[model samples]
Target: MHPAALAGATLGRLAHHAVSGLVGAALLRGASKAAPKAKPATRKAVVGGLAGGIVAARWLGSAAEEARLKAGDMLAEARSSLGEEAPPPSAVDIGGHDHDHEH
Candidate 1:
């Protein structure tokens, strides 16, 4: 086999073994716990993970919307000043209207 291919295969196997070992250790630890059978969904880790995910999603969505609005405004401004000529595709105006579209 090629040297690079051999290295990649070895790395892949090592990663797989490492991940499997970690998962097995975690599962064994959980099985060994003597705690009473509590509801799985009520775990603190699960709730915290869910809340963090929701917050991240909202933040990303708001940021994307803000960026889009800013782009639109830049396009409108460019169109107003450039006038009649077709603005470059990358151009943004002060308002978000398409330069080619009739008002």
Candidate 2:
């Protein structure tokens, strides 16, 4: 439940929604060409696609969030079971570089 993780998740969800909406709009625009009356059908299809995309994106985001939370919980349980503490961010090493010394 770190704030950074929460913000990242939020941004990821929004990205998913935006991408899906664009895809839906594109698909609907193509599909509308088959209709007998082009204008009205195109308009309706665009609207419907946008709405459906939003709903689909919401569902996808929710599922992803659930999985993320579950994974985090599992990791926490494993750490607790092993009686190990995670290092603080500043104390952790990255890419084989030691962070123990001041820059």
- Model 1 segments more than 4 A misplaced: 2-19, 30-42, 85-103
Give the TM-scores of the predictions, in the order they appear.
0.50, 0.46
Candidate 2 clash pair list: none
Find the 10 residues in a row with the least total lDDT in model 1: 34-43
User: Model 2 lDDT vs. the true structure?
Assistant: 0.85
What is the Cα-based lDDT of residue 47 in candidate 1?
93
What TM-score does candidate 2 reach?
Answer: 0.46
lDDT of 2 by residue, 1-103 (tens): 9999999999999999999999999998876766656778778989999999999999999999999878777876788889987444466356777668886
> Model 1's lDDT to the true fold?
0.81
